[model samples]
Target: MSNLKQELKENIIELLNLEEFSVEDINDNDALFGDGLGLDSIDALELMVMLDKDYGIKLTDPKEGKEIFQSIAVLAEYIEKNRTK
Candidate 1:
């Protein structure tokens, strides 16, 4: 699901207003928080919204969100398996 991963990268940059980053700047295995991409709790919330709105996947647990948001690769796999849209 390379296309899905790419779309996710694009959407994240746009959604978070991360103007300093580009799609090519984010690797599939890079962490989305703390150090790799340097995202914070606010960005995570936005991503959760994007997941629900774009993939029809609603997350209810913060712990689960932590696991899914580990990296673009992991997120893409989770979406491929669980996405309803």
Candidate 2:
């Protein structure tokens, strides 16, 4: 689980081009949007692509991403349960 969280953090930094934020900057429970990482709609789209392309997890509904992408912990848990790759 920890490994998955770390991987998720790394992937988020790389995929979203969060050059200002290192892995250490991201907290497992920190929000990924709004006041936390401040990721907007475009970043969400990129993450959806990342999920499909990197984890073989297809999310047909964007609204679903709101909960799944809430934080690294949540995302990692969701991926652990659903990842095909």
Candidate 3:
């Protein structure tokens, strides 16, 4: 699970071009948007693509994406349970 969280941090930084942040800067409970990581809607869309392409988990509902993107811990858990890859 920790590995998943670390992987997520790396992927997010690379995918979003967040050069200002490092893996240590993000905590497990840190929110991925708004005041947390300061990600915007565009970043969320990129993450959805990542989920589908890397994990084989496609998100059809925006609301569901909102819930899953709450934090690294939550997202890692979801992937652990649902990832096909």
| Tens digits of lDDT, candidate 1, 1-85 | 9999999999999999999999999999999998899999988899999999999999999999999999999999999999999
Error of 1 at 30 (Å): 0.5
* Per-residue alpha-carbon lDDT of candidate 2 for residues 31-71, written as tens digits (9 for 90 to 100): 99999999999999999999999999999997899999999
lDDT of each: 0.97, 0.94, 0.97
Clashing pairs in 1: none
Q: Model 2, 2: alpha-carbon shift in Å?
A: 0.8
lDDT of 3 at 72: 95
Clash count of each predicted structure: 0, 0, 0
How good is model 3 by TM-score?
A: 0.98
TM-score between candidate 1 and the true structure: 0.98
How large an RMSD does model 3 have? 0.4
TM-score of each: 0.98, 0.96, 0.98
- C-alpha-based local distance difference test score of model 2: 0.94
